[model samples]
Target: MRCGIQSFFFLTLGGAETLLLTSMAYDCYVAICRPLHCHVRMGRRLCVLMVTGSWVMGSINSCALSIPYCQFRAINHFFCDVPTMVTLACMDTRVYDYMVFLSTILFFVLPLFGIVCSYSQVLLVVYRMSSAEGRWKTYSTCSAHLTVVTFYYSPFTYTYLQL
Candidate 1:
């Protein structure tokens, strides 16, 4: 069904977004907390692997849910959300709903939690620095990262969570 295919695309997009935010936070943590080893820890190969893994996970999650929704054609939301689209199906959607709910928790909520935790620890370390130069440098780096995270997340949260 067209709705199922659209749902797959949107779910993959959402999963990839969540993974990207999580990876960015992890990169920042290494850059700030272990600056000496950042180059070693976040090498090109590792970066590529992380990105590839995220896409693989996103694709798997998307396909797993979308495959079941082939019976449905209508989707209620302006955008494709698996649960919402599944609700429009004429057939039973309990299993599909459960899968979507689980995938959301794993791909979205858990990654967000990790990102928040990583940033909190990074901020705590920044706050404890005594020297003016150290403080300024740390603050500068953190402010940039925070600005980016806020810019990306605020609108998404406002649109999805509030709605």
Candidate 2:
């Protein structure tokens, strides 16, 4: 159905966006926390791998969620949310729901956890710095990243968990 296809498109786009943000966060983490080894740690090959993984994951998730919706034709929301559309289906959707849950855990929850852990470690090291200047510099570098992380994660959490 058109609605099903549209939903797949948007979810794919959203997933890709999340992946992009996550990759950027990883880059920032390396740059700030491992300045001397940034080049070696984030080489072109690794960057390519990260990006390819993101897209592949996003595509696979989108396809997995979309394939089961061949039975459903209507979409209630303004955007195509695979979960919502799955709920509207007349046929059994237990398997589809389970897959969506798994994908959500994999794509969103796990990445969020990684980002939090990475930032926590970075903060700990920054706070342990002996020099005030070093602390300030580290904090300054991390502040922007933290702000963006908060902005991205807050809404994502609210949407997926709280709300």
**Each candidate: RMSD:** 3.3, 2.8
Residue-level error in angstroms, candidate 1, position 18 = 2.1
Candidate 2, residues 1-163: lDDT per residue as tens digits? 5654665566666666666666666776787678788778767887676667566655555543445544526565677666666676666878877877778788788878777777777877777788999889878877887787788778877766666
Model 2 error, position 44 (Å): 2.1
lDDT of each: 0.68, 0.70
Give me the candidate number with maximum lDDT: 2
Q: After superposition, how far is residue 86 of candidate 2 from its true place, in Å?
A: 0.5
Candidate 1, position 88, lDDT = 60
lDDT score, candidate 2:
0.70
Task: Note the clash tally of each candidate.
Answer: 0, 0
Give the Cα RMSD of candidate 1: 3.3
Name the best candidate (by TM-score).
2
